[model samples]
Target: MKGLKVADINKAAGLRLHRRGGEAPAKASQQQPAALSKPGAAATASKNKNKENAASAKPGNNSKAVRLPAVKAKPAVVDVPPAAAAVPATGNAADRCTESLKKKYSEVGDVDNESEDCRDCLLVSAYVKDIFTYLQQLEISAAAVRPDFLQSPSRLQITPRMRTILCDWLVQVHQRFTLLPESLYLTYHIIDAFMSSDAGASVKKSEFQLIGVSAMLLASKYEEIYPPNVADFVYITDQAFTAAEIRATEQRLLKQLNFFLGYPLPIHFLRRYSKVAAATPAVHEAAKYLAELARADYSAAHLPPSGLAAGAFCLARELLPSREGACGGSGWTDALEVFSGYSRQQLEPLVRQIAGLAVRAGDNAKYTAIRKKYSSSSGSMVSTWPELDGTGEALRSAAGLS
Candidate 1:
């Protein structure tokens, strides 16, 4: 919004020009001619002054300055494709509730702090990307939106053992009756987002399916999606998770979360603002990283997905690799201006928790059993449970396929 100043540019160019009260334009000629007439004035001038005089006094010394056309530089506008639209924009009360939830997190203020630029956040975002990449491993394409299938399977060929790990983890997530399927899907989304961002972690073939499932478990309850069916979960794991065991772990997870399941996250708000602002490519990426980091933190048993997303993005503007190039530009600036009412301060604690979770998730070994199971179960088909027949709309809606 600031106007360009010609004087500032001139100063930077280091040209000494008399625009102010340095010397009157005619003062030098007036005094010099009179002074030079005096005997002392002739000798008083230095050799450099004589040279200047000689140069100025030359017959053909002066030449008109050539002027060229001044072309104004215009700002470039980047056209970015919108995030995949949700199944139908038509709103029911439940959809309205989800929208409200998005609004809640949208209110968090962004943090200007760049103090904690580190690999962990990048690693976490990359980790989330890998999970989504792993979804390609599922290789199950529903008839609807196959082309728009935003998630891709793993590029690095995974071992059969690793395959079992993923499936078993999925079962494990399903087994956690306390969590919802929507959260599980969200968890996968976060993992994919993270993994896709980080090249190394995805290449290392780190076992992230377990972490992904755990994070999903955390997200489901928060989103109020389909709660996991404990008995069905046990069946998926072949009774590996007893009712008592699942309940105990759920309790532990709840305690770890300080019993707060209702926290708003980054994805909901990011998508909303991104849509309204038509954010640039860079801010879109920053939002992606923030969203995944937020999701990863949910698995820590410490924070909720919504809280983490809010905090991460609040810090994201400061932390992303392109933060400087991305922030305060038309992209981010426009988004912020429109969504200025939103703040990131409310999510700081969650961001810290997510950063911590990113560290812990990297080292956690709870996925050993789940990974082993996932790898081994590929040849055998997972049993399809009977669903009461319904319209495609209802079915699609239930599976979030709508």
Candidate 2:
């Protein structure tokens, strides 16, 4: 929800620029009193010259000078083309948007410098507010048409473990492409949306991988600046799926969802609330680990993205050392509740589920990809932190669990 409304915000900002451009001519006209004064002065001078010429003609005996009429230069009309007039204003607006994006991406966490910190906070807040409104509308529309997994015909053949395996594979694909985190979450959403639809009811087990890959491809196209080609996906899967098949599946998936791909994802909320909490890199990494774990678990499909993000953040904070100068005050839960729109009681169940998934991921061999992925240095090795295992009881207690 936080990042979903970027398009709408951008449109509004552009409109504001156009409106300012339209007003520029009016302001310039108001400042041109000299134009009006120049015309009056010219008329007065012309009248005096005409009178003198007439007097000279009447009294002149041998004066043969021809009196030429003084023609006032018509006021120069400088016509400004609409396109040219709007160019500078549009450029200025674009520059501001670009700067905002640079600032948004440059700072991953809290800023220590006072002025720079405040600027970053304002940029992020404005961005999130716009996105939140857009996401609310999307949620309302998506809910009306959302498929019911419980009654889905595909649920008969597709087991939860199968879904986990497909999702785990998707995680690997996502990393390979270096896609945005939102892409992976949207990929899962697409897969789930398709599975719960009538079209996916008759899909064969052999074709499951095809569905997963197609979903990822579509999500990439939607969220990525440059999405990978169908061949790339086929190659990634070792040619288990051909390009033609992938394209066809893409069309099917699109038709099923009515081409509405923008859904509020957990990553969107996680990034916002993490900033609100002023979480450290380690806390963020740990939280991401938990969130991804939840992604791979089929049971988490029913949980709202915001709740899942809050749960992951709560667990992440419990797993890491507290920051000395965190801005969220002494009560991290309160900050999270306010920023994430979920109370502690509402977040407790989700937190418990996420924590349970974290614990199980460490113990289960089948779920090794996520654990191993996070164990690498690139992930900050947050998965291997001792506090993850050591703080189980504390985390449970904090979540209001027995």
Candidate 3:
């Protein structure tokens, strides 16, 4: 971790102070410093000035001049919460992977070249491929966690339609809280896991919504930077589920999941595949809409996250008019096949399923939350496209998938 530098916060005469050479810059006294006309003049001047300056500038130096907290500042009235527990100084596996991504991208080619924009971010992490590899392994177990609860004769209280309704309502709660994308996906996974497990046997028909709200609260705490409080969650439920009920159910749900919160989401796979195609912003958003739209679908629950991601990306490419020559003007290409590890033929079925969901999104009032949410300006209104009415050949082909 990098320590805060006092020099960064305390500027002297709109000029940076030098903690070196036992003297300030001759230009420091000047109201306006002379402009450097020559290339590397700043570097040349910095080298000639002082060695002590470099030592002071380095993070964690013992110099009092460099310590940020040592300097005094005015205080303000603010509600101070209790001190949080000590955060680990060392990086976790995810942290380590992100740190590695901060390195420069040195590979050649248009695909690699385009990704230079996201260099030094987790989007282009070096370990991204390996991370997804582990996620793929992890998803196998997660898939089994959600049994055929819809088809199970033993679970009579919850119906497939009820699951869809709960998911739709949860989407509204998710947007209301402005939670992360993972929280929405994880919430659904928790709901599915709990609904299918032995814990689901005790659920009454009236308690289904309670379970949805509680699962989302648990997911928000796990994924959000600052999750909403239990009171906020209760308020979102119209006070139907009290804070006590939500907290208690959260505890039960966590135990039922055996504390395993991580699930391989379709969005995770779509990111990698989107990079491969060099997909446009509209296309990427459309893919996300499709993938998220699938969450309301109980049938897609049995499908792999990667397939859903790949299919969504492929279908998005078809739905939106292409401005670039992505994938050689084809929906699927050799690079896509190599990266996604799925063939065009393999994606056809899932593409049809996703397309039907999109086509019926508006007409189906039961699933209107997703469509209406996407139709908003914040989502770029991808759902409002007239093409989704099924008049477009792309949508029709995707729907038929013959």
Candidate 4:
């Protein structure tokens, strides 16, 4: 693989930070110091020759200067807790990656044009490789620690429709707070994992909403820098539950899951695979729409995150208009399979399921939340596009499904 620049990689991977840099530059004031344009002229002119002589004549001047007590400024108040005191002051992974890229560029200064591009490509490849390796480890760990549906069939009160409804509501809540995609995925994982546990078998249907919101709350805290407050969650619920009830439910859900909330999410896999495919924004949006739709359906729960991501990516490619060199060929599919550890054949069934889900979300009113969300301009309006119907059938045919 050719080395790519970090800026280019960031753009391709959708990790570009949209935020403005720290405080705006201070404006220049009209008032000027007396020494303007004449270096040290004001200070030199202000000095008294007599005072200098008088100070030099004093024999105890050195002792007096030394005797002056050192004054110290008080430390500024930091909002961080003592437990997080040991954390590095440096920013997140993306920021660190950018800094490393800058350092590499500086060190390679004035190199031949061709060599510089090659070196940049190599540096980018190395950075991406490191990130992919870390995600691979996480994928393995997530599979190992993933919660199982151990409860007897009779004990499972939460039906598929109920799960779908909960997920739909969560989508609205997620949008209301403008939470990160990771938070939404984590919320789903947390809720499902808790419900599948032994303790969650006895939870009443009335408490389902509370459990769902609490899961989202925990996910936000884990994935967001400024997570929404519990009161905000309560308000989103139209004050159906009190702050105390929500907190209590949060504790219960956490205990049921044994505090294992770090499971790998489909979004994580989607990011990596999309980069490998070099998918366009439209395709990426379509893929995300399919993935989010999967969250609402119980059938998707059986599929692992890796399989889900591959399926969504496959569907996204099909949905996009056919352009020369635009779609992933055999090599691309093989690369995704190797990276995600799921062959095309293995991913086909999930792909079909996701396609069906996407179609239904558009055609059916019950699944309208997800469809409506994707219809908005801010969402890229991927859901409202007319290509889904024909593309879905094509995806099904290609997947060897009826």
lDDT of 1 by residue, 234-277 (tens): 34434334656556645544554446443333355554454344
Residue runs of model 3 more than 4 Å from their true location after superposition? 1-124, 143-147, 153-155, 323-329
- In angstroms, give how far residue 340 of model 4 lies from its true place: 3.0
For lDDT, candidate 2 versus 3, the one ahead is 3
- Candidate 2 per-residue C-alpha lDDT over 56-141 given as tens digits, one digit per residue, 9 for 90 to 100: 77855567778899999999442311111111111232332233333332343222222254466656643454465455335444
Q: How badly does each model clash, as a count of residue pairs?
A: 42, 1, 0, 3
TM-score (C-alpha) between model 1 and the true structure: 0.28
- Candidate 4, residue 80: how far the Cα is off, in Å: 42
The 0-to-1 C-alpha lDDT of every candidate, in the order given, reads 0.37, 0.64, 0.68, 0.64
What range of 10 consecutive residues in model 1 has the weakest lDDT sum? 379-388
Candidate 4, residues 234-277, lDDT tens digits: the string is 55665677999989998998777668787778897787777655
User: Counting only residues 3 or more apart in sequence or on different chains, how many pairs clash (N, Cα, C under 3 Å) in candidate 2?
Assistant: 1
Question: Which structure is stronger by lDDT: 3 or 4?
Answer: 3
State how far residue 285 of model 3 sits from its true place (Å): 0.7
> What TM-score would each prediction reach against the true structure?
0.28, 0.66, 0.69, 0.64
Best by lDDT: 3
Model 2 root-mean-square deviation: 17.0
lDDT per residue (tens digit) for residues 173-258 in model 3: 66655667888988888888787787787888778887887888788878876677776655555556678888888999988888
Model 2 accuracy (lDDT, Cα) = 0.64
State each model's C-alpha RMSD to the native: 25.7, 17.0, 18.8, 15.1
Most accurate candidate by TM-score: 3
Which is the winner by TM-score between candidate 1 and candidate 3? 3
